[model samples]
Target: MNCLLTGSSGIVGSHIMFEWIYKALVEKTVNHLFVVIRNNKKPAKDRLLAILNDSSRPHFLNDFSMADCLSKITVIPSDLSNIKKQTLEKYNFSTVIHCAGSTSLQHTTDSKEKVQHQNFNVTKQLLTELPHNVKRFLYISTAYSFGIQKDKVTDTIANFKVQEFRNPYEKSKYESEKYVSETCAKKNIISQILRPSIICGRLIDAPFFETPKFDVFYAWAIFLNKYARKASSDFRIWIDQKSGLNIVPVDFVAKAVLHAFLQPNIKELNIVNPTQILHKNYVGDVLRYFKINAFNYVSERPENLNNFEQLYYKTIGVVFEKYISVPDLQFQSETILKFINQLNLSTNLGVHENFMKLIDFSVKKEFKSSYA
Candidate 1:
């Protein structure tokens, strides 16, 4: 049976296109593949073909040829909301992986009410209008869907006790995931919910140490890169000494997505790093890359600040500070380790090992974009 994939243009989705879909084609597990990429300046096939045809992408994750994989795939150029029923009937899809959604973390009313909530709306719309032949459904939800978990986060959903979310994106995913799980149970569809925590660059899998977007942690890296001047000198940046952020590589995420499909019995999987780079060590490489020596992680908030610190906190820090100052939540991933183990893929380390590589790549890319 064939599979229909959404969000083929995103970083995680594109990685799956390069790695999992290619591997699946070689293994003959999937007879064919269908991709739903929204129309942009170019047709969906042309846009997605450009990404798949990148010869410079790293290997060792999969050894399939691009041309062979291309022949087995069909492009459906439609938005998630716009996919017609006739298209599903014609394709006769057995599995649908819904990975397309807004990742915006904005807390503005318009963003929360419309943009971020669009994830939930689109997901609901798709599930409500699914074809009877679609027996399996996979929803790519964020690990942070735990919202503001009071303590540890298990693979189980009922364990989440968060009343309020840090941002609308987190809240939106939580709502969407809840809807997917509950709806799938009623419809008798095999549902696999994969929650990925802060997807970044690769550590082991193909395109080793590569990332499409330098976002999340890399945004902070870019900030430090910008702060390379004398202006940030002696200006303290506060961090949580005990808590850590769960940032996993894109390849690791792609691996988890593949395994989630393999082990459907193991429904919910947190495709998160086995370990987190505690807030204290999260910025170590970026700080070193920029030769930054002014920041320190403190359990308690600092009352005193220099002029720069004052200005920084009042401005961009208002948003960034929200990320660090939150309750500690340990994401459980041992259940999925059974599947990850089969592939002999390593996800033991978090973002620390290749942090500098990400910093270098992002900084250079940012520089190029800024100048270009």
Candidate 2:
């Protein structure tokens, strides 16, 4: 059977592509691979080559050549929602891995519309346009799609209202999940929605690339690092210290995705780190890493701050404060844990040494400069 994988250029998708390629190289379960990438200045094949050559993916390049891998894969350049029926017929895919989606946190009209279109519309179109041979559909969604709910988020479709979303991205993904659930049931498709929490950089350093990094918290931290001169040590950002952040390294997430994909019976999975870090501690670690001043956790925003302090708060707080202010969420991971145990995968939660390695990886890659 062949596989159709989308978002081959993204962090999670690229890692997934690498894992699948490695699996294909060894097991040969997948006969052909169709990678769907967005139209850009660079060709899809060129982009895939860059990913294969990316320093973070050295494991994939250990024993293979670009020519050898490309022989088994077809890079399709087009909007995912616009994939033609003829192309689907030609590929006759059995496994469809839908990892492409808009991930903007901005709430502007255009941004919201784009998020909805890319996340929701693309899923609808793919479900409708895919051929009958397609058996498995794996969707990459965020655990934050649980929204501002109180209960623990389990391996089930969250029943969240539109207003509960922190931003358009979450709302769009929630809507897309609902649509995928309904469509899969109606069309008798075996679907798996994988909700990963706060995917960050790997624990290994890599070469610098001009591409944008997908980690939002790290991006904000890097921004602060670049503009460290703009604000003084007195500047403080308030947050709830008790709230927990369920974060996972990108490499771990990739392994979880593949393992969950091979599981016997699964409808939904929460690919999250078992040991969650406190939001306040996470922020403190970042600030200390950047040599910034200390910050105290408060229930509400503090008053009487300097102009630069206010600007700093507004700049980073607007997009990320919701995470720090919300109540802690419990992301159930029984299914993924089972798979990890069965596969004997590394369940290394990013803490202490791993955390430092992750941040250092970003530093080596100069994420601060590019993001700032």
Candidate 3:
């Protein structure tokens, strides 16, 4: 199978590429793996070479050690924003995995135009203009695309009006998904969309510093530790006790995507999230893991607290306010579990282990001098 994979430098993309080239499509089935990268980014040759030379360097290096696999992979430089129709005609892509999109939650309507351009417009162009030989166009979308309904969110795609989005990123992705579905219907192209919730760490290595969602928790922990040390009194970050946070590791996400695509008749599948802990539970677990006693409050109590407690509450409040507003963010895991059971791929998704590893990695980096 000749495949076209985009977003090779991204966290999800890098993981997907590693799985597809090195593990799943190894040896015979994959004749050529064309990696579509933006020209302005790191040169594809250099990126691939870096991976090949050292797979343990913390970047997208795990797949690099597979030199035999890399030989079959070809890097194609093309901007998804302005990919020429003629250029796509050059290669016969049996499968096109679109993983490129801005995952930023802070983008405004005007500020997010470029992201929308890349996510929606570019995808529209690719599906509409691509050669007829393309069999499947797989899009990597976010679970948040289900919108901030706060109620039960099913794995099935439901129609959400444009104005209902919680943030510009969500709105843009929804718009892009709409366009892809519409265009695919018109073009008669087979397409599948995979919506993954907040992807955490890999069991083996870090994906990238720039695309750090799972790593942010570690950073937050470090920041809190530093703040605690710097502060004159007892320190704690306050969080709501009722809200839940959905976090899935990168390994499960990659495996699910691959499994969904490789399955005989399956068109779409939402990877069942194994760890959907309540926000307070999540924070409490991390704090407990680190031996930090966090004072949890059921109601807003900023007025009674002293300066240090007030500041810490304010800091955590911001993050809570942003994410807590997301509707129906709690994902259904039965589908993902069914698929995993059916495939009998390694039963250990390692969600907690991977998260703990991330924390360990950060703690080591933060206190290397003192520990050494």
- Candidates in order, TM-scores: namely 0.90, 0.90, 0.80
lDDT (10s digit) by residue, model 3, range 1-372: 678888776667766766676554443434667887654456767775544343323444343555655766787777776777688888767788888877755444564786677677777777766777887778888887766665555676654333566567777777787777677767777778788877666553454221223342344566566665434544444455566566666766776777766762566566656556566546666656555564444444445665656665566444345464232366556777786677564444555435555566556556321100
* Candidates' C-alpha lDDT: 0.72, 0.72, 0.62
lDDT by residue for model 1 (220-274), tens: 6665566556445565666766777777778777767876776668688888777
Error of 3 at 109 (Å): 6.2
Error of 2 at 321 (Å): 0.8
lDDT of 2 by residue, 77-178 (tens): 777878776767776578888998877887789989999998999888888888888878888898877777776667775443435878889989888888
Model 3 weakest lDDT span, ten residues long: 208-217
Which residue runs of candidate 2 sit more than 4 Å off their true CA positions?
158-163, 204-214, 343-348, 368-372
